[model samples]
Target chain A: MSRASNHQALLAFLDTIRRPDVAAIDLGEHENLVDSGLIDSLAVLQIVLFLETEFGISFAATGVDPGRLYTVSSILDLIDEFG
Target chain B: MFVNLDVGVLHEPLSGRRWEPARLRLEVERRAAHYRQQQLAPGDRVFIGYGNCLEFFADLLSVWQLGATAVPVDARLTPFEIETLVRVARPRLFLHQGELEPSLAPIFEACNVSPLDTDAVPQSEAQVPVSSFTLDDDALILFTSGTTGDPKGVVHTHRSLRARWIALQQALGLESYRRTLCLLPTHFGHGLICNCLYPWLSGQELFILPPFSPQVIMRLGALIDEHEITFMSSVPSVWRLALKTARAPQKGSLKRIACGSAPLTAHLWEQIQAWGGTSEVLNTYGITETGSWVAGTTGGPFEAEDGLIGEPWGAVVAIMKSDDTAIPPGYGEPCATGETGFVWLNTPALMKGYLNRDDLTARAVSQGWFMTGDLGYLDAQGRLHLRGRTREEINKGGMKVYPADIDAVVERFAATRDMCCFGFDDPLYGQNVGVALVLEDTSADTLRELHAWMKHHLAAHQLPVKWYLLDAIPRTSRGKINRDSVAEACAAHEPVDLANMLGAGR
Candidate 1:
């Protein structure tokens, strides 16, 4: 999938898991999901699940870099590199 | 300095800070002398507002040295919530490392309590006070609930705490705990009383981490392997993250791992065993009132089974038919083997009672046996198993968030006409907070104001993650809130569009 498509898919998945009081799409591309109050600490687990299921990104084999998953920009970069 | 405290080496792996026994003792003495200068005495309650570091332990021992009860406050609490507890506990000294929250200053002023800086200690290593404390005096008061209401602090005497440590030592030896890591918060009973203290106070090296930080959890295996941690205890949610994102520890130094305070399924239990490279992941059974861990899967050899609690460590586990505490010496006949009933525990390690709340204590304890609000049964093989809890608190992962506490805060808000907080099934946390609201106005302005009120009075974790708007909350015939029915009703309807609603107001 294209990087733009991956970003769209990731944003959709985040909207489902983000806190009810916050809009995931409203967050900046460089904004940290947790630090920016878009999601809870545990909600990161759902993001990991979304990566494996949708994009076939396996953290176990590639090793997780928390920074790569913290922001929309970093996540798109990760998809471009791994996907 | 006296050496009977049994405190071992304390380390913070994230910061790479370590305090040896001699250095720890000196730190404790300096802080103890500082407290003495501030006129801290026996029977006084000293609140430590921060934790998960070396200084926190020093302050704990220092408070004990002065015969004062240590109250470890959750720093996340809003100033309003903290003041509510301050009014109840009536602490003599509020110990924090640095500046108090700007809003918290007035509370100390009105309450006439001193906020002592732990870092600003006496220069000399003061000798232990003469006749400072006894084993029967209150050692710690860990608050379980009622942060925004009447806070219920579980008071454990030094004797009871020692009983817990001794009992744990007798049941679960200290060899495997030679190097232990704790990721749970120190304000919690399971974290302070068992996971941190049981091993650390038994003269073992303790490695502490900031509680529930995904960054730290992401590198959990590396932290464990670097420290060569032999034993660690955490909730299943943590294991869920570790098993997925973090690389498995390669050193194979894990002698045992324990998951408690939340339900651990057989699938997840086995997953933890594999990820940690050890088969000793025991699903521990404990509560704040019982001084944390009372029972776990420590009986001989056993396969991981759903709800299997194994056996008691230093307590007599009984499954009873009746939990009518209104009657004197409240207890009933024991259930037949393999029959589910109220799980009652008789332990020396049970908390003295709720701090200064005998009315609440009376409702929970009867005779010598404390009626645990848990429902479970014993197998023919003489093992205890947990089925469910009858308590009103929402178990968000391992952290117990009381529903009434949230309701108490929300009800006080002008925009909230009626509110009911309940637990909903969550994939990551096992259960998360859900609120059913009957608001005075459904307009975005009122909704935003209500959200602002909640954020001010409640911790982020305690705030309802899911919200439902209703005409009125469904209630029982007698007008009591049935959380389950309200939860069921809310599940049927779509939740309020809080993000859009608040955004519209903005």
Candidate 2:
């Protein structure tokens, strides 16, 4: 999948995370998912499942890189690399 | 310091003909070769949530053989938490050693595991290639509850975990017992290493059961008798229940009953001793970050002192003051023999660091000691006594609610205000969640409406069972609301005769 297409899918998944409407997540900006308070460890799972089916990639418990998964940019980059 | 405790003694009869370590390695190697054929690499991470004893050990040994790391996720996690961990750890394979419920069926990647799966074959005689590994190698990755903050993955290297097991061997002086029952899940620190791995590695046999229940322990009595079982370790709660409910065993040989993971109340300890099963009741102290058996009471002369966690096991303990300095002469923060502060340990068994969390790794470990967030003191006799944890106070039965979790739901209500919530002590539940509110209206359904909304959005445990309305919550000068004060205010009780509230139950 192209990075642009991956980004689109990522935005939709993030949108469904059940944050308050008042919190108003800006999908185009505030790229740091942790800092933006948009996603936390719980959200990470949904994203992983999405990545597995969408990108045809899998992760193992031992070789997980938190930095690659914690942030949206890094996650997209990881998907691109694995894809 | 002198060696006050005996290091080695066989407390239980042999459970079986002693199984040599070479035989175990051979079995593990066979399993490892099979796993490798399925494309699992030496560095890959896999989740072992299986509750079965054989699969747990074999999968673990397979990981050891492949020079890979195994992360055991507790199967008891609420579905939400399990989903969270699977994503965080990103295990390629999720092994179900126990029965898998339908809820977990959706997310779990299809695997060759599961006893009923036709694809899986038991390797009666298998061999694994020799792999290079060290004590410092990452052996296991376990997660903290994240009760207060985000749960971080704790990573223990082989060296650290093995050193811990060796220290336990020296501390408890374990001999391979004949039939041992494992009640705690493998995901837990105390159960996996202390109860299972440590015993198996020492040529002992382990009998696996689901988490402890009175019925289960009673059934185990027969197995113990059948197998000539000896030593057992379990959480105090399980033993307390077993003592209360189970029929007293007749003509059984259970030597040492060790309890840890939570405080062992003296009342409960005395009850266990009262039962015909006479064994040295040892109270152990350790955490997930510390590779299981860190400090514990020995079978030798031990004072029945309440709160004493005993001295460190083959490790050094330091009590640090609020200023991040070791308290001088051990009086401040309870390190000097009778003072209390934050407890820290320099041990070979400490985990290398939090998995993928360098920031947390740096904060928790400093100058070679892992700073356990638990608050406790060391008496002059060098025994440690824990007071409580430094993290947010939890009232599992009371009103100390997780504000983040509560607020997450309250904000969803149309008429609700963005307000702070906290927990207070409730007589019925240990801790109950109470929210300081600024809602538009106060009708009779206020409580009913709030409860209904929470039920849909929050887990039963996460819901605030009680609600308290406040004009505004107290805030610090820097603009952070002081939750401790809010909680204290909520806790302060007005003397009310029970007759008044219930009206003598008409």
Q: Which CAPRI tier for candidate 1?
A: medium
For model 1, report the TM-score of its A chain. Answer: 0.88
Candidates' TM-scores?
A: 0.95, 0.66
The superposed Cα distance between candidate 2 and the true structure at residue B358, in angstroms, equals: 1.4
> Which tens-of-lDDT digit does each residue in B1-506 have in candidate 2?
11011111222222333334454455566667766666767667777765544545656776776777888765555555556666566666666644566665665643332222212536653754667566566778877545223557889887788788788878777653444667776777888878877776665667666654323543444545665667777766555434433445556577777778766667667666555376476778877788876886663577566676777896887777752534322334433556777778878888888877888788777667777777888776777788776655444421123466567568767768646677665322334566666676655455446656765555555655445565566677888876677666545533222222222222
Off by over 4 Å in 1: A13-43, A60-63, A81-83, B1-3, B122-128, B326-331
What interface RMSD does candidate 1 have? Answer: 2.6
Q: Model 2, residue B449: what's the lDDT?
A: 64
Off-target runs (Cα >4 Å) in candidate 2 are A1-83, B1-31, B97-127, B130-132, B147-149, B176-178, B217-228, B323-335, B393-506
Could you tally the backbone clashes for each prediction?
0, 34
Number of the top-ranking candidate, with DockQ as the measure: 1
Could you give the C-alpha RMSD of every candidate to the true structure, in order shown? 2.2, 18.6
Error of 2 at A56 (Å): 62
Q: What is the C-alpha lDDT profile of model 1 across B1-506, one tens digit per residue? A: 22256678999998889999898888887888778889898899999999999999989988888889899989888998899989999999999987779888899989978998787775775776554677888999999898999989999998888888888899899999999999999999888889998899889999999998878888888888899999999998877777778888899999999899888899999889888899898899988888889988887889988999888989988888888665322336778999999888889988899987999999888876788889999998889999998888887777889999999989998878888999998866778999999988887777778888999999988989788999999999999889999999999999987766664554
